[model samples]
Target chain A: MTSKSSRREFLTRSVQGVALTATGGLVWSYLLQQQAHAAPHAIRPPGAYDEAGFNAKCIKCGQCVRDCPYDTLKLAPTGEMVAIGTPYFIPREIPCYMCEDIPCVKACPTGALDHSLEKIEESRMGLAVIDIENCLSWIGLRCEICHRVCPILDKAITIEHHPRKLSKHARFVPLVHSDACTGCGVCEKACPTEIAAIRVVQPELVQGKIGEHYRLGWKIDTPITQEFKAPKRKDGKDTPATGLDYLNQGEI
Target chain B: MAVDNNTVKPDTVKLGPNGKPVRPFVMPSTLVGKLKVWRYIIYRRIVQLGSLLLFLGTVHWGWSIAGEPLLIGNLSSSTLFGIVPLADPFAVLQIFLTQHLLEQEVVIGAGIVLLIYTLLGGRVWCSWACPINMVSDLASWLRRKLSIKDSFILSRNIRYVVLALSLILSVITGIAAFEWVSPISMLHRELIFGIGMGWMAILGIFIFDLLVLRDGWCGHLCPLGAFYGVVGKVAPIRILFDTPTCTHCSECVRVCPEPKVLNFKKAAEVGMIASGDCTNCGRCITVCPENTLAFGLRVQSNISKKSSNKLESNLRRAT
Candidate 1:
């Protein structure tokens, strides 16, 4: 109220206001660039959409964070590495429990989480990967903690028998199948390593795609064998027996 | 509110050596009269705190009816009875600006909220529903009680520019720009769901409002309030200025949070406070000793011809 409200002064303030707004907005955008990019791999709750879809659709209401009974999910606040206000979990600290009811997804007002994911087993929140170097089973120690704790059991994580050098024993290595693993982080939490040997991460980080055109000829499902069948001899008869066969017949 | 600047009852005001009213706005004799003075404030508190209670109760304590959680989300987006959806329209608009179309439920929810505020007056959300209002109100109240002088001057129009910038930045940033950084959202969301570094930002707002300027955030810097102001333009509910009863005591102007909206010449030209900036908080109505202001339908605010003519002549003479 102390300032004069002359016409020229009003225009000057208008220009100043615009300049301030633009400068402030740019600063805010810079913060967004630093903060809102959804961290390296903040594992989401079950039924979350693809990262891009989830980022766009999530209203940041924290309903999913609120409804998670196990408190596995947290709304990323100002200081977290995840996109600010989006629901994410640190698997090593508190992994998704893979609740049968999928309460968190149900609580999402928007379908940032896929509502159609009725069974929690089907929700690929992330992919669990093993660090072979640190894994107890890989080191020939008897630690199958990850395999034992996986909710999907033998289907999601099965043990592979690998023969050890100069020993009659075999190392039972736990294998995580992308097809069945829900990435619930149970295995990550249960691992007995100093730091978790098995960890959940966004699938794209480790998973490789067998391109659509590639074919495994050895697999029964692929029919490359038929295409590679050699043409029949022009004579339509078998070739003469080799020298070994002829000698064997002559009793040499 | 400044006690000296509040409404002066004709009999209650003491005359000073110069015969000017001093120590205006004395307390009433009866408890009911005192309650009448704070009726709107009490209702506002109930609405604001009641909303928070609903969210807190539902989230923390399993408050439900017929197996349905009540008001699951915070103010950004929520569902009533797990059926009727509600969302902040401005947030939705920012998301929309990001080129991401929301689900029909949220889109409809935004529409429902917009329609309600459009009818009730947009900043009604600010006074009646926003939790930040309580903080801002406390700041202003303490300022008046403690006689805190504003450290700086700011334009009320800055909020509109901020609103525009938020939308533009949303497009550029590929996210809800304001929603990401908004202290309003941070405070309510963190309070309802969980605690984080959110309170630090809200604390900044409180200090900024309390010490730097009176009604600084709500009146001058909140893009959400500005968005609602634009949405609630031509709102059916408005503060009708009764020209005949007004004594030109200037109390309403002093008490008004958005005092510029109560322009006397403009209100005289039109029989109502026509600015979308009027929050319909009814502070002016409550403080008017002469009953000069009241809520009325905007369409029906055409004053009686005699009063209109008188106000027009007064306006001319004053000019």
Candidate 2:
């Protein structure tokens, strides 16, 4: 009788363990997929508690809504009364300008907006992520404006060296420096593509979670110089090449 | 000599022709003389004492605002009479809890005070001296100037929706959203000197009163008014009518801003007249020229039965 009962318990435990393992595996896979697709995006700068904080300590007073330079923010409606006066920016119509000196941060009296950021790069508005599939350069075309206009330039925006195979013309494409990118979204603004090949979403870890490790990564992750070698033309006289040549040029 | 007409009833009473002093009249019936309605009026006065204190306390708070913050909730003593630079206290509470002081004791205390008073007096806050009611009264006065037609909207149940929303949002966001509906806060900010158009909005309503609708916004849209309506449901004191003396001239109904009180005339019995909308403003009593109405008390939970025709006649003969 003892052996029979023990066998039944063992069978129950095996079934339960198998079910748990399958569920865990599915959850792990889903998380992995999400992480793979997710890239850092822009975030509202931290207020009061962090640098570039809005001081109003803000009581969520609606004063900021009336005073916003861009009128990008409004009262969140009675239903959203909790969020009341906190401002949120919509990137499609009005994105954060990454002003060399933050103006809104200074306007806040209660420390809802923080005015302490000295460098534009140090201000984490959010991070910019490139959709390689949608990016013009990744399509073997000639768009590198994002890398060029990036405020930190070589520090924040860098190029990857990839050799293309077709004709006797220019070669290589520009890759992004993700770590240096503050996701100020200026590049998304500068993108010549009509539909805007790049866009921004709020990044996880929010703003102000950066510690010594993040700062260290910012310093060491400077782009490798060789990757930025200019695309060479057959004539090689520093002549700007055509968009077509940029596509097939065995670019490096 | 008109002996039957002139003889005063032992149990019944008569107000002098002027409607102020009372004279005892001969008992018209056995039933109402036994009820002894005058005792109930005295009871109402007892309740009114507490109501009067609440009104004075609210005003006294205004006097203290020089040192205190404009809004309610936990605040630091160093915050200048518990006043912070921020006009509202939700932000202060947020800052406090983050610092681990858990200063929520003060806010909870204020909530208890409001709850106890509401259960007792039934929106006595509105009838006596809620700043919002004061503003509504001002708006009603303006309604006479504008001659706005159809000003009072029948929205008795709307306040429950508002209170529920306020509680739900407060729970969800951990911030006090009800400050917007606080009449004292609005009055202090808008009527007294303050920066910005928040004041303008309140004043603008008066200006709007000039164009169309009498106290249109306050009568229809004031969430605070709605809250008072809901809280007054269980009020123990009410304005009971001696219906036979009610000449059916509709003067009381026409004068009553609260439609529920007017609807009470149609009710079966003039027992406890406490509905959610009773403000205990005494406006009905003030306007009743016939001396047919008086404030009365009842058992805490009794639903009054319709007064009999004979009882109504007794009330008329007594008055």
Tell me the tens digit of each residue's lDDT in model 1 across B1-319: 2333334446655543223444435557898988898899899999999999999999889899999998888899988898899988998888888786567878888999999999998888888889899999899888889899989888788899888888899888787888888888888888887788888888888999889999999999899999989867868988888765555566677778898887765676677888888888888887777676888888767654347777557767776
lDDT of 2 by residue, B1-319 (tens): 2223222233343343223334223333565653452343344445544433432333234324666433321111112233332222232433333332222333443345446556556566554534445455666766656566753443445445444554444333333334433334444333322233344555666555444554454444455556656656655666665644544334455445564455533432545455666666665665555656666764521333344456556656988
Please give the distance, in angstroms, between residue B179's alpha carbon in candidate 1 and its true position after superposition.
0.7
Give the interface-residue alpha carbon RMSD of model 1. 1.5
Worst 10 residues of 2 chain A by lDDT: A47-56
TM-score of 1: 0.84
Candidate that scores best on TM-score: 1
TM-score of chain A of 2: 0.51
lDDT of candidate model 1 versus the reference:
0.82
